[model samples]
Structures are given as C-alpha cells and as structure tokens.
Target: MKKKTIIEIFIFLLLLVFGLHSDAQEDHSKMNMGQASNKDEPRVTVDVPQDQQSKIGLKTTKAKKEKTLHTIRTVGTVTADQTKEAHVHTKINGWIEEIYADYVGKAVKKGQPLFDLYSPDLVSTQEEYISAKEQKSAGSDIAKVALERLKLWGVSQKETDRLVKTRKAKRSLSFDSPVDGFIVNKTAIRGMYINPEMELYHIADLSRIWIVVTLYESDIATISVGDDAELRLPYDLNKTFKGKISYIYPEIETETRTAKARIEIENKDQKLKPGMFVNVEVKKDLGEAVVIPDDSVIDTGTRRIVFVKTSQSRFEPREIKVGPRVGNSFIVLSGLKDQEEVVSSAHFLIDAESKLQAALRKGESQPAGHQGHGK
Candidate 1:
C-alpha cells in the first residue's frame, strides 16, 4: 500500500509540472502575438478640444490643386548689348589730321565724319585712279581696277564720288562713323599715326541693354528664354523696368555653383547705365499641382509628416512626399488628397501629444510581466 501511494504522488507531481510548463508556453505565445499586433497597427489620430485648440492657436489650411508660382529674386548688373557695339578702325596707315568726334561718350550718327586722315598711300592710290581716268574711259578695265583698289583701301563712297566729279586727288580724306552710338572709348588724338590694326573708337548703342543675373543651380530650371522679369534700380525704387530672359549660360561657375542668365530690356532713354546694380524678380508658373502651406510640414530628418484634419477635433499624422517649395506653400507629390484640411499652425504640440499617446498605447499592449523587464 505504501509503494502504490508513493507512485500516485510522483505521477501527480509530474502532471502538475507539465501543466505549469504548458501554461508558461501559452503566456509567452500570447505576449509575442500582442507585440506583433502593436507593431502592425497604424498610427492613431489625436483629438483636441475646441477650447484647447484655440489656446494653442491652431490654424488649418486646405490642401488643394493649384498653380505653383515661384518668385526668384536676385541681383543683376546692367551691361551693354554686345550685338550693337562697334569698333571703328582704319583700313590704311594714316595720320589723324582733325578729330570731330573728339571726346568719349560723344554720340555720332552713321556716315557722320569722325575725323580727317592723311595718308601717303591713300594719296598715291587716288593719283593713280585720276591718271587711269585720264588715260582711259572711267568704265575701262584698267580704270575700273584702279577704282576698285581705291575702294578696297577704305575710301568711302562719298569720297569716291567727289574724286570722280572733280577728277582731283584730295590730300586729306574724311573717315565717317559706321553706326549711330556713343563712343565709349577713344584712342585717336590730333596728328596721331594710325594703322589697320589700331582701333580708334569703341562705340556702343544703348538703345537696348542687358541685365546679367546670377542663378543658383537649384533655380536654373525655373528660368527659360522669353520669360518675363521685373527689374528695379536700387537708387530708384519707384521706377520699375520690364525685361525678358534672352539667354542662359551653358556652364555653371564651379566656385559659386551658379549660372548666368541675360535679360534684355529697352533702354531707349539711356537711363540704365552699364555696371549699375538692380534687383531682379522672375516669376515662374510651375503648372498645376497639389500643394499645402509650408508651415504644415513636420520634417523629422528621416521623413516628413503633416497633420491632416480628419474631423472637427481629430488631426491625423500622415507621412507625405513633397517637392520644391513655392512661395509660402509646398508642392505635395503624394500622401494627401485634394481639399483635405491640414493643420498649418501650432502642430508641434499636437505632434508631441500624438507621440505620447502612441507610446502609452504601445506600453498597454505589452505583457505586464515584461513591462519592467529591461529595468
């Protein structure tokens, strides 16, 4: 009887130990499932009372599809239009006999006499042409060749006509201005010897001017040829000038990482002088896109989040992909729908509360025994 009683007690003890082992396994499995469920759950929305929202100064703006207008403001320097510039040089070696356009900045018209030049070569060519005319008809081959040589030697048409009419070689010939412009540079002096290689005058037409502006690499895509720009002089804020982008430089500056763009503006009044600094504003329309106020975004380094108003008092934290910022708004590439209201002000506090609530919920889902396991 004692042996059978001892066997029964051992069997009972074994059953009890197995039952405890199964219970422990069940608890561990339940804990793992609860943690997994918490991990897979979506982010929860937070609710704020109306009075609390007023105290926090919460403001909301609706995300909507609209044209993104970006204004790029920069500084530019005025420059002369290179296409309308002229460098006056003589084709023959000559002595300056007289100077009519005497000073720099003097405006001269086309065909206007700039100076009188005396050259032995010119005089000899003229004499030969006169002799050829005397020996043969004016249209004869020899006479034509002599006349052509004189013309190639830089003798003006008017001077040639005079030589034909008078049949006399003049000692001094007048050199005319080739274009209507102000002489920005002058190297000619009375009695100074000049040659074909010498530049006598540098004239520039200021009727049209160029404003060169520097654009950062980020802003290069916002500008294009024919885009309108507004320019304002630093000295004259009340006066505004309008222009259009005429060219964009192909290469970017390595040091500054910027490129240059040229804006053409009419300067018929000659008010915009070269080298003057002006403010430039270029407005670019980036077509239509979904956008939200810039203040509504919460950038947490790894990702961007925005609080979307789902109901009267509920704000849902949503992750979104955003593009470039346009003015006070941001272009939303995804994650939010059009016409959805987003919190634009006082969202930081809401974000803090939402994080706190999430932490509490995660703690509640954890097993009670494991709650203080790390500590």
Candidate 2:
C-alpha cells in the first residue's frame, strides 16, 4: 500500500509539471504572435512638443499650387550662321590678275570687286558673243546662246551688257562679291593660278550670329525650336542679347553624349564674335503643380518620405512621388496636397525619434512572461 501511494504521487507530480510547462509554452507563443502583429501595424504619428521643436530647430513649409519655373543655365559658343555664309568660287580656270578684296577679314558689299581674272576660255567666249552681236543677221539665236554660256561661266548680266555696248572683249574680267560679308578666308593672290574646283574666298555675313549650346539627354525633352533664350557675355553681364532656339541637331555627339541647340540672335552692331563663349539661360514654365521645398523630402533608397504636419505638434510620415526639381523646390506628383505643411528642418532627428518611439511601443506590447525571459 505504501509503494502504491508513492508511485501515484510521483505520477501526479509529473502530470502537474507537464501541464505547467505546456501553459508556459502557449503563453510564449502568444507573445511572439502579438509582437509580429504589432510589427505589421502602420507607422504612428510623432508628437513633438513646441519646446522640443524649438530646441531641435524644426521648421515647416506649406505645400502649395504654383507655377514652377525651371531655368537651364549653360555655356554657349558663338558661331557664324552657316546659312548666311557664302563661298566665293569661279567657274572657269583663270589667273588672278589684280587683287581687289586683298585681305582676309575685309568687309565687302554686294557688287564690290574681289579680284580680276584672265581666263583664255572666258576671253574666247566673250569674243564669240561680241562677234555674234556684230553679225546683225548672223541670227539672235547664236548671240543668245553665247550670252547664256557667259552667264553659265558666272558673268553677271551687267557685265554682259557692258560687253555688248563696248563691242569688244576685255583682256580681264572683274569678279564681284555676290553678298555683303567679311572675307573670312582668302586664297586669292596677285598671280596665283585658280581653277573652277578651287574655293577663292569664304565670306561670312555677321548681321546675325548663332549661339550653340549643348543640351544633355535629360534636357533635350524640355527644349524645342523657338524657345526663348537670353545670352550674356562672360566679361559683360550687363549687356543681354535675346534670341530664340532656331535649330537642334538631330543626332547627339558620341563623345559628349549631348545635342547642340542653335540660337539665332541679331549682331547688327557686330558685338558678338565667332568662337566667343557666352552664358546662356533658358527658362521654361512648368504650369501649376503641387510643390514642396526640396529639403523636406528624404530619399530612403526604396521610398521617398516626407513628414507632414498633421497638427501643431503631430507630424505624419508620408511616401510621395516627385517629378523634376524646379529651383529649390520639387514638383509633387502624388501623396501630397496643396496647403499642407511639411517638416523641412531637422528631419533626421525627427525620423530617429519616431523610430525609437516605435521600438519602445513594440517592447511595451510584449507579454510579461516574454519580457521576463528577455530580461
């Protein structure tokens, strides 16, 4: 009977111990479940007292709907307008007789003589035209053909009329400037033999000039032909010249990975010179949009977070989408509204305090038994 009582007591003790252990394990599991659930909860607002805010130098700015003007500033080089440039060439081979334009950089007007040329072929054609003119009934067709041939050889109609009136072929003919411009390049010499294939002079009209600015791939989308631009000399900022984007190179340069934008501005005073570097500013207005200060937003790798002041003391963290930056502000694409105040200064301190408070809350929600175990 004693042995049976002892064995029964031992079995009862074993059962009691196992039941307590199971209950403890169940409680621990419930604590773990509670912790996971708290972790899944949304972030809570941070409350910063006015005194604390003052201590932290906290500041806020209101998100507002306003026009965002983007200014693109870049350096540009002045170039002669290619379309306004003229190449002086001759059709028939000749020997340069009397140099008239004489030097490079000399400004010449239309019909101004550049040089005198003596070409055997030209003299022979002029004689034929003069003979045909003198033949009277030799027929007008022959003279007309000869005149057309002279025109084809680059002889102006005025020169041809002079020949007809003079009734003689001149030893040398004067080549006149076809356009008003400064001779940028001159290959003509006093006795240099010239051919039809040779370029005699390169004339550039400086009445208008082109300012070429480089546009990166990111900026190309915002720029277009006819966009207004302002240019200023590096040495003289007080003088400003206005222009419009006249052309954009279709292909980007392989080495620079940039496209060239051409701005045409009048240079009637010849103040701008080719190859001179100038400052270029292009302004684009991005219509009304919800905007906030640039410093208010924090990029946390995966998300862009901004703290919005929901109340005087309460700031709620919000994830927002943003577009291009305009000046010192950002264009808010979503997750924000106009007139809402957002925290601008001391963001790091606020963000850290918010996270600390969350961790403390998580700890407080833990079961007592688990807390004890952790302790």
Candidate 3:
C-alpha cells in the first residue's frame, strides 16, 4: 500500500508542473503577439527605387576645387591718350592770309609750313635785318641778327634761304607745325583772322589710346592697377585689343552710380578711334574663392537651392551660399565641398521629379487596412 501511495504522489506532482509550464507559455505568446502588432506598416510609400531617383532628365557636374572670382563689366568709350595730345596755337598776331594746309584733314610734319600770315611787325623786322647787312658796321650786324631770328621762330630753311637769295621782303611769312600729326581740329577758316594766343588746330598723336570703362559700385573693389583687360569694338569684330588698368575715378557717376576705370592700350596702327563704342572685360585674382558654373544655381526668394547628385539615382536639394560672379561661374562660399557632385544643367526637371517621388512615398507608407487607402 505504501509503495502504491508514493507512486501516486510522484505522478500527481509531475502533472501539476506540466500544467504550470503550459499556462506560462500561453501568457508569453500573448505578450509576443501584442509586441508584433505595435509595429504597423511604414507610415509612407516610395514608388520609385532609390537607385533611379537622380536620372530624371538631370545633368550634373562634379564639385571642383577652383579659385573664386568676382567682376563687373560696363560700356565704355575710347579716348585719346592725354599725354600724347597737343594743341597747335599761334603766338604772333596775324591773319590767315593763305592757308597752305588747304583742308581740315591734312597731315603735317615737324617744321612744315602750315599757313601764311601778313604782319606789319614781321615785315618791319625783316627790313631792319636787310639794312643792317648793307651798312657793314658792328651795329648793323646786330640788325642783321633779326633775319636769323625768323629761322628761330620756325622759319624753314627753304624759306629762310630764299629770303637771303631774293633780298626781297615777302608780304606774308609761313608758320610751321612743331610736331608730326594729323590736324585733329581746325578752328581758323581760310580767311579767318588769327590773334595772338589763338588756338589754330589740335594735333593728336594716335599711336596710343585709352578706354574708359564703367563698373558698378560693387565691382570697384576688385579692379587694381596693372590688371589685364580686353576690349571688343563695334568696328572691328574679329579683333580684340589688350589693355591694362591705369587709373580709377575718385568718385562714382552721379546718374549711373558707376566708377569709371581707365585702361591704356597701344594703337600704333591707329585702329582705335576716339568715341568708339566698346565692350570691356577685366581679369583678376579673387584669391582661392569657392566657385561653380554660372548655370548651376537656382534662386528662390527664400533660398538658393542646388541639386546635389548623392548617388546614381539620388539627387538631393541643398541650400547654398554664393559669393559673387566670375565670368561664366559663381563663387561658392559655402554649403558644398570640393569632390561632391551637383546638377549643373537640367536641374529644374530633377527638382520636380524628386518632390513628386517624395510625395508618393509618403502616401504609400500607410497600411492596406489603415488611412489613405481609399485615395
């Protein structure tokens, strides 16, 4: 009887333990089920694969390490180099009795007779010289010295030598030009009276020229002496003139608010004429400025956005800070790196595609039995 009782107790204890284990397992399974339900379907949807995002009609350029630059261009006029310009004037009071110059556009050489003028003061002086030579006295030689004085006053050898051979006082004497240049200005007409200190003509030496370039107030800082410049004139389409920055105006233009920069250029061929219209571009170093192609940027009022190609098909829009313009590029001050890739062309199309894809992914994140399914 005892042995049978002991066997029954052992069996009873085994049954109770198994029953508790089963209950514990059931409770654990229910907890696991609750935990699985907590993780719902993704909150949004993504239709396009991540690999094909950036290929939506997008063109790109690698961010390069380059110097930054900023410059301004303006319309300018060609001017005569002031250092080479001269005005021809008459020192002796006279009339334009006979103008050997003939016309306004005549070329004259140094010591060449330009016009003849009749003056009582001149004729009397010549007569005095003749009388001095005939008397043959020391005092008379002093008077003859007057004849040589005419030569000192720009009388050519041909004319002065003739005066000695002819021994006759010419009614009018010739006045010569002091320099070789074109007659840029002619104030005295054929018969006009020319007074002492009268400006008869203006001769401009055309071998050198100047270009007056205007720049916006902002660009005045980059231009400096010795910087190189280029000009394209309307008359010469195939030609380009090189020049150097020579001077800058102290003040800006009142109406246009621009600073005028003077560039000196050599025109030994006389191709650059005064008042000629030209386009000028200046080149300078901005000193390691960050930059990108001019076409790579899109400016919205709130932000300046650039499309960065993160991977083969993933383009991300990033807000960037730009400094200034340098020819066909912009100086990227920040928000980009040297080796990253950015969309340089066709960025607008890619922008639209990325936004649309983002919206679609957001919609598909909802579960099949949850909200937004009907739409």
Candidate with maximal lDDT: 1
Q: Which candidate model has the greater lDDT, 1 or 3?
A: 1
Native-to-model Cα distance after best TM-score fit, residue 136 in candidate 2, in Å? 2.4
Q: Give the lDDT of residue 215 in candidate 1.
A: 93
Residue-level lDDT of model 2, residues 249-328, one tens digit each, is 89988988888999999999999989999999999887899999899997766567788887777777777999877889
Off by over 4 Å in 3: 1-62, 67-74, 128-169, 285-288, 293-323, 333-337, 340-375
Q: What is the TM-score of each candidate against the true structure?
A: 0.76, 0.78, 0.61
lDDT to native, each model: 0.80, 0.79, 0.67
lDDT of 3 by residue, 1-375 (tens): 578546545543443333311112222222211221222211111122333333333467776777655555667899888887668776667667887666666777877888887777678777777777667776466665787677665556766777777767778888877777677888867767777578887877667888988888878877788998888876675789898999998997888888888999998888888888898888777888656787888775545667776555445567688776787877777898887888787665444443333334445556777764567
Task: Report the candidate with higher TM-score, 1 versus 3.
Answer: 1
Q: Supply the TM-score for candidate 1.
A: 0.76
Clashes of 3: 9
Candidate of highest TM-score = 2
Clash pairs, candidate 2, are: none
Instruction: Tell me the deviation in Å of residue 318 in model 3.
Output: 9.0
Off by over 4 Å in 1: 1-58, 137-139, 299-304, 311-319, 349-375
Tens digit of per-residue lDDT, candidate 1, span 89-199: 988898999999999989898888899999998888788878877876654666677678777876778898898889898899888888888999999999999998999
Clashes of each: 0, 0, 9
